[model samples]
Target: MASSPFLNEVRTSIRVRGMSIRTEKTYIYWIRFFIRYNHCRHPTEMGAAEVVDFLGHLATERNVAVNTQRIALNALAYLYNQFLKQPLGDLES
Candidate 1:
C-alpha cells in the first residue's frame, strides 16, 4: 500500500531534526498503529483521551511491558507536540 502523506510529513520532520533512522521507523510504526487503532481517524481529530485509551489498551489488553508502553507514549507525544503542534498536556496514562 502507498504511504499516507501524513506519515511522509512525519519522516520529513524526523529527518529535519537529525533523528536516527531506527527512531524514525519506530515513531512511524507507532503512529501508524495509533491511527489504525482509532479506525484510521486523523490525528488532529483526536486528543489525550484517545491517547490514554490506546495506552491503556496496550498495558491491559496487549499486556505490553512498561517500557513498550512508554515508547508508544513517546511516539504519540511527538506526533502531537512536535508534528501536529497540539500538545497533549499531562495525559493521564
Candidate 2:
C-alpha cells in the first residue's frame, strides 16, 4: 500500500494522545490493512460494514486468533472514532 499522510497523521494523533509506539504501529497496520483490503478506499468513505467484512475475512479465511480479531476491532474503532469522528455502533467485529 502507498504511504499515506493520512495514516501518518493518525499515528501522530495516537502519539499525541500518549499511546505507546507499539500501539501506534499496531493501529497503523490495521488501518493500512483495512484500506488495502477495501481496495485502498479512504476510511472516511467506508464504514462499519467494511470493518465487519475485514474481520470476517480474518475469522473465516485467515483464521486469526481471538485476540488478534479483538486488536483489529480496536484499531478500526480508533480509526472511525478518533480519526474520522464517526463512531461505529454495535459493530460485531
Candidate 3:
C-alpha cells in the first residue's frame, strides 16, 4: 500500500472521523495554504513555528475572519496530531 502524504492522510482521517464536508473542505484548504506559503514544503519537515507564523499571517496579514482563523488552527492541529502523529505541544499566542 502506498503511504499517504501528510495532507492526504489528514483529509482521510478527518473524513473518517465524520467531520462535516464543509469542515473537511475548510481544513484541506488551510492545509494547502500552509504548504504553498512555505513554498510547498512537506508538512513532515515543518513544525509548530511554521504553523504559528502561518496562523499569524492569516489573522494579521490576510485579515481573515475569526472563524477562518480557527479553521486554520484546526487544520494544523489535525496535521500534527493525526497525520504526522506528533505531539504539537503548546501553541504560543
The lDDT leader among the candidates is: 1
lDDT, model 3: 0.83
Candidate 3, residues 1-93: lDDT per residue as tens digits? 333376676778898999998988788888888999999988879888899899889888999999888878988898788777886788885
Off by more than 4 A, model 2: none
Candidate 1, run of 10 with poorest lDDT: 84-93
Which candidate achieves the best TM-score against the true structure? 1
lDDT of 1: 0.95
Note the Cα lDDT for every prediction shown. Answer: 0.95, 0.91, 0.83
- Listed in order, each prediction's TM-score against the native is 0.96, 0.94, 0.84
Order by TM-score, highest first? 1, 2, 3
lDDT of 1 by residue, 51-75 (tens): 9999999999999999999999999
Prediction-by-prediction clash tally: 0, 0, 0
Model 3, residue 42: what's the lDDT?
Answer: 86
lDDT of 2 at 53: 90
**RMSD per prediction, one decimal?**
1.1, 1.8, 3.6
lDDT of 3 at 50: 90
Worst 10 residues of 3 by lDDT: 1-10
